[model samples]
Target: MSAHNFLGNLQTYTDGLVEEGKTPAVSVAVWKDGQLHLAASGILNVETGVEATTDSIFQIGSITKIMTVSIIMQLVDEGKIDIDMPVRTYLRDFAIADAEASETITVRQLINHTNGMSGDFFPDESRQSGNQIARYLDRINRLPLIHPVGEYYSYSNAAFAVAGRLIEVVTGVSWYNAIEERIYQPLGMSHAISHPMDVIRYRAAIGHFADQTHPEGWKQTEQLYLSMGQAAAGATLTMRAEDLITFGRAHLEGGITQTGERWLSKTSLAQMQVQQVNVPTVSKAFTKGYGLGWGLLHHKQPEDTVYGHGGVTYGQLSMLRVIPKQNICFAILINCSEMGMMTEITNRFLNELASLDYSEAQAKFVNLSSVEQKRFLGTYASLGDGFRIVSEEDHLVAYYEDTVLKTPVERYSLGALEDDFFYGFNRDGSVALELQFKDCQKDGRYSYLFSGGHLRKRVLE
Candidate 1:
């Protein structure tokens, strides 16, 4: 299809999809061959009955991490910081519960999520103050190292908080301000704002939760944002889909802005996309590997690699995908927490536009022996998340718990895949879970469960 017809069909599909009640609102922007196409449909808020427009700002969640890392890279370009240098080189008093890790963790490890620090270390007090980064530092002693430093890949929000502090210390500015001056302003992203207060000036979309009790089958989320302390890790950044894609285009153009200005060095941009660690297969639904701040999606061919990130905040879901080989990038923003819908949209968008499919490769399913299955049947936990796998009628079922968000318990059935990996399907048979058991202990039980970008330890009863 021609580009004109493809974008028109995308817009029509988006309109119909929203009307199907998957989500209350969504905004999408596509950048291909130096042209921009945008689409929007549905209401910004069910309560207000306000129509969403192409310019409506939705929380980009962890996509903000890219901006955070961009500022850190800029510091590197200026010789003000070094990725290999220990974070303590700048934040002299920075220390975590693990003294050795506190002293030895480098800035690169923090950005690439290899620091082994607890991933979800949000404090209630941090949300109540503007000096959240400082409060986060004061409470750093509470977070324990989940694994040995540089042992493996584990998503770390605290790591980025440390990165944010490093940015603040080296630049003499707040993380939010640094992002504005360095990224938003440089890229001409006028619709982007890292601070929640600034959101009021734009046509911002309110988040919605899937609530069967509500008349519309969804309700507005009580909280509008996450803890300010984790802002660098994607707590409170909002932007129009257009602006989000513009940010992606900067990286796509190798640090050059749309107006021919150099926002970042080509060397730093290349380093950010280089794979730092290979993620677990189960987590490949999100990413195949980790870069500095980007998620590397390795397609069938090496040159077809795609760089992107996903974000979630309260009841919103956002995704940004950039395929440099095709000079194509797209951003999707939705107000409701409907992940299944987001996945569907992402697959369709990529397949239709770039002729690239991100659908999970069909794993060779195998039946594990009863004893082998028992190795994975137990409780696994990270900081605020956990899973309990139980066997029923020769099949494994997992119960997921989200303590931080207080979400309802969810259940998934695990089908054994190759090499201790499992495909988790919801009751509706959607392949929403990717997980693996790794690091066997001397007692024959696996020491860790890798899923959702977290290396959760098996909880011993």
Candidate 2:
């Protein structure tokens, strides 16, 4: 289906999310074969009565980690930085709570989120200065590691902030400028601005907190000025939905801008997608892996992989995904974050898109007879207990026990039994699948690697 048609469903999906009190506004874009498509539902600013448009910028939150990682990778490529070297070797002031572990931590471990870092050292608080973050890390590092370095998955904004400092120390320039000059400018993403202090202002979108329980009534996002720690979690970035598509396209094309400038080699981009550790205990059925600053979700369904990052801060949530082989990309941003509406809307649209048979859905599957596809359509069970796939209206849908998780089939793309099993979207619009299904059945069914460790359905029905 053309993006135009796909866009209609996206708007409807997002509109329903807004009506359901998930969020007040959202921005979404789809990029394919170098072409860009954008659509949004709701307002960028509810108080100003400003409707969300293609150009509205968003606080990309942790997604900024990718930018930080990209710059660090560039330094690595230049021999200015070493991935395996202890970070203290470069930033002499760098310290960790575990005196011995601090000496052992490498830049690579930090980039892959294996540094044993947490979201925050304090309870019910967010945002920290570089100095404050450094102090907090010192305190947290003393607390024994839940798992040894490179053995577990613990998302850490502090690790990335340390990375930002490393960049600053090595480049002798502000981390913000290094990113702008190296990544944003070369990619021609003029609208993409980092560091809340930048003078560039025009298309930026202010973030909104819809949750009323907080003392501050739904207000503008706090600026991250004079805060190097912001690089990891709170970097203020503003960009239209269209420009972000370009950034995604670069990854799709293997890390080179459209004009053919070699910013990063294909090898480097591949390195970023490498699973540093197996995140068996996260969301969904498939393994959630880490590659530098991005998240690698290998969905057993549709037999494809998605690489990118998702971010959240205050009332905003953002996501960017690059389907490397398909040369397709999607970006989602919302003005409000209470209740996880941004995530739900994004999942809904992507799930709908996933339901479409890429072979026939992408102007290719139209000829496959719906009857011929029925054998693959029966209610195959998923890895999660009581989760199964059933044929609905000639399409494959996912159900948890009796409750449908994803609606409408997005073409059941089965993979080699050895590689992947049962694929498509479940009712919740999440990428649905049962990875390593045969193995699970043989063992009397254990926990599904996905669904963050839940008993899986083993018997096929």
Candidate 3:
């Protein structure tokens, strides 16, 4: 079916989420071949009942990691910094709990999340002053290494915080200003802003906390900000789903924007997406290996790859995906800590767009109606999180949105694979994860996924 056909079901589907109290507000978009498909539903605020739109800005959490990496890549393109250089080269006074690891961590390791440092320290809790990130780096000096640098995969928000500091050292500007100057402005993303106060100038989404006492209700979350201290770790920058896809397109197009703006060298863009570390345990399953801010995703088949990132913050959640081979991108943003809404919406949308094939090679390859293609079309869930595996005309894709814990929901894409039994591969094709589905007439369908060291089960209803 054409993408527009899915739009018909989108409204009804989105209404179900809001009516069910699973989300407060949301904005979603998919971009391909220079065209866009968009949708929205729910309210921006639970109390105000402020209507949401495709333009509604959301706190894009760690999705900002991609923007941070973009700036770093811009610097790489300009020869202002080298990815392999030691972190100490820029922050000479910086120290971590593990002195040796702190001394040896490379810039590349920090971006790919293998820096071996404690990453979640949220100092400057007040989210104050533009100078806070500098202080954050100072506070970071006291942290011990989580593992040997370059030896393991650990998602470190602080690593990105330090990355912001390094951006400051290289560019002579605050990280937010650098992102605005280097990434957003060049791409012509007018509705995107990195700081909290600035978001007030636009139609924005207010994240609402899901009620702990009542699973089906929501209460307003307190206003929050991304302190200049933690901006790189995606403390909370509001963005429209459409604007993010514009950024994704830039990445898919090799650091070049649709308007012909050159954001980074093609080589630098490629460098940022290259798998730099193993992240087999990431719950989102978008990628098995970590790249810069991006994760390399293997679709439902071997050799199929895509790259993307996810975002999360208090009362907010986001997911982004980019298929470079097809120049296709999808972004979903929502307000509310209840991530089940994201799971429901993203799964249906991806499946609806499964037949999208704009390229000639892709058109012939996707042939959606083939018997082989139907084998993978279904919703598979594990541990209350949802994963959708569908046959895109060209390849099989495993779509995921995880809300197992914490603020941000994890949204991911994995390559779907099947032979004698079903399985999945990471974006770089390094890890093989088993996927088992069983039919149960009484209990509905069930999925058993082995991830994060347990067999997580999600029901298909």
* RMSD in Å for all candidates: 1.7, 11.0, 11.5
Q: Residue by residue across 354-422, what tens digits does model 1's lDDT show?
A: 777666656678887788778888999988898999998888999999877778999999988877888
Q: Lowest-scoring 10 consecutive residues by lDDT in candidate 1? A: 121-130
* Model 2 Cα lDDT, one tens digit per residue, 1-461: 54457665766766776666566677878876556777777766655667776777777777788888888888888889989998878976666556666777789988886765433332212354444434433444444332346655656556777787788778888777787898788999877877665524655566675557643345555532323444544455667677778877877787878898888867678788777776542233345677887787777664577787887665677888777766778898877645345545555545555432222111111222465334333243321124454455665444444122112233333321222244344345444443333233343432232232222323444
Ten-residue segment with the worst summed lDDT in candidate 2? 356-365
- The lowest-lDDT stretch of 10 consecutive residues in candidate 3 is 357-366
Cα-based lDDT at residue 62, candidate 3: 87
Better of 2 and 3 by TM-score: 3
Q: How much lDDT does each candidate structure score?
A: 0.87, 0.60, 0.69
Candidate 3 structure lDDT: 0.69
- TM-score, ranked from best to worst: 1, 3, 2
Better of 1 and 2 by TM-score: 1
- Candidate 1 local Cα displacement, residue 245, angstroms: 1.4
For model 1, the superposed segments whose C-alpha errors exceed 4 Å read 1-4, 282-287, 360-363
Q: Candidate 3: how many backbone clashes?
A: 25
For residue 117, what is the lDDT in candidate 3?
Answer: 71
Most TM-score-accurate candidate: 1
In the predicted model 1, the residue pairs found to clash are: none
TM-score of 3: 0.74
Per-candidate TM vs. native? 0.96, 0.69, 0.74
